[model samples]
Target: MLIRKALIEDLNNIMNIIANAINDMESKGIYQWDNTYPNEKIFSNDIFKNNLYLYVDKNIIHGIIVLNEHQEDEYESLKWKYISGNHLIVHRLCVDPKYQGKGVAKDLMKFAEKYAKENNYESIRLDAFSQNERACKLYENFGYNKVGIVTFRKGDFYCFEKRLIKYGS
Candidate 1:
């Protein structure tokens, strides 16, 4: 599997993965996503900003994520551990339903951490749906400290932060 910068041509495939994720989440009673939140416009903006990434295997996209400094507006109210300096925020992390338990999301996250370390980012911040137990556990297992909770379009989300200075320092 290869993870690289997303291109405009990959938008449809990316959206398909996201759609699968939405369906999976809905079937599991996780209301974290819907038709409106992560639309094509948002993905397009990420592509335009050069922050979106894709996880591919044999030229087939299986996962998508965004690594950048952009943070949710509600994140400002939280008291993060490493507040100063450049920090990479993980957003739009989703894997195709077919690749869900195959560690696709984990691979994307590892890539994001490596990207942050390479770019001298001091920390990594992200939010997982409070109701998405699997995601919350994944972040915790990855050593992210849950600092607070914030509400997004759907509902409550747990904000997590992990310092990268040990790797980047």
Candidate 2:
């Protein structure tokens, strides 16, 4: 498997994987994402703005992720705070449902941690929908500690952060 920066040409394929993943989630009673999350305009903007990354295996995109360099102002003003300094905020971490249960999310997270460490970021942060118990557990088991909560369009999400040391120490 290969993890690399996403290119404009990879947009449609990535979006399809996203759509299918959402549908699978919905079927499982997980309300994380749906059609509205990846409207045409949003995917177009993400491609044009260069905010996405993809995981490829044998030339197929099996996972997708969006990263933000800073926390939004609303999160910034919240009562809870991060460990310190700049953080790479992760969003829309979706693995193709076809490739589910194969550690894809863990691979993406390791990639994010390396990305942050190399860029001098102090930590990696993300929010899991409160109702998505599986995601919440995954975050905790992956070394992220819950620091607070924030409400998003779907619902309130538990915020988590994993501090990164220079060499994974």
Candidate 3:
């Protein structure tokens, strides 16, 4: 398995993965995403900015994650723990439903942490839908602390942060 930057050619596969994820979430009563968000346009922008990444194995795209510094405006109200330096914000983390339970999301998250450390980021921050138990548990299991909550169109999301490096250490 390898993680690499997403290209325009990968958009179709990425969209398919996202669609499957959306269907799976909705089927499970988790309305975290829909057609309105994470559309092709947003993903295209991520690709254009070199922020999107893909997890591929044997030429098959299994998952995707966006790592960047673009935090939502709602995050401003949250009292984040690590406020001293640059932060890597995780977004749009989705694995093809077919690849679910196969460690694809875990691998993607591992990649994000490594990327942040290599880039000298002070922390990693993300928001998981409060109702999405799988996502919230994943973040908590990975050592991320729930800093606060932010509400979006669907509902409230728990903001989490994992400090990667101490500023003075």
Q: Which candidate is the best by TM-score?
A: 3
lDDT of 3 by residue, 1-169 (tens): 8999999999999999999999999999999999999899999999999999999999999999999999999999999988998999999999898989999989999899989988899999999999999989999999999999999999999999999953355
**Inter-residue clash pairs, candidate 3:** none
lDDT of each: 0.90, 0.81, 0.94
On a 0 to 100 scale, what is the lDDT of residue 109 in model 3? 93
Pairwise lDDT winner, candidates 2 and 3: 3
The Cα error of candidate 1 at residue 154, in Å, is 0.7
Model 3 stretches with alpha carbons more than 4 Å out:
166-169
What TM-score against the true fold does each predicted structure earn?
0.96, 0.90, 0.97
Any residue pairs clashing in model 1, and if so which?
Answer: none
Q: Local error of candidate 2 at 130, Å?
A: 1.0
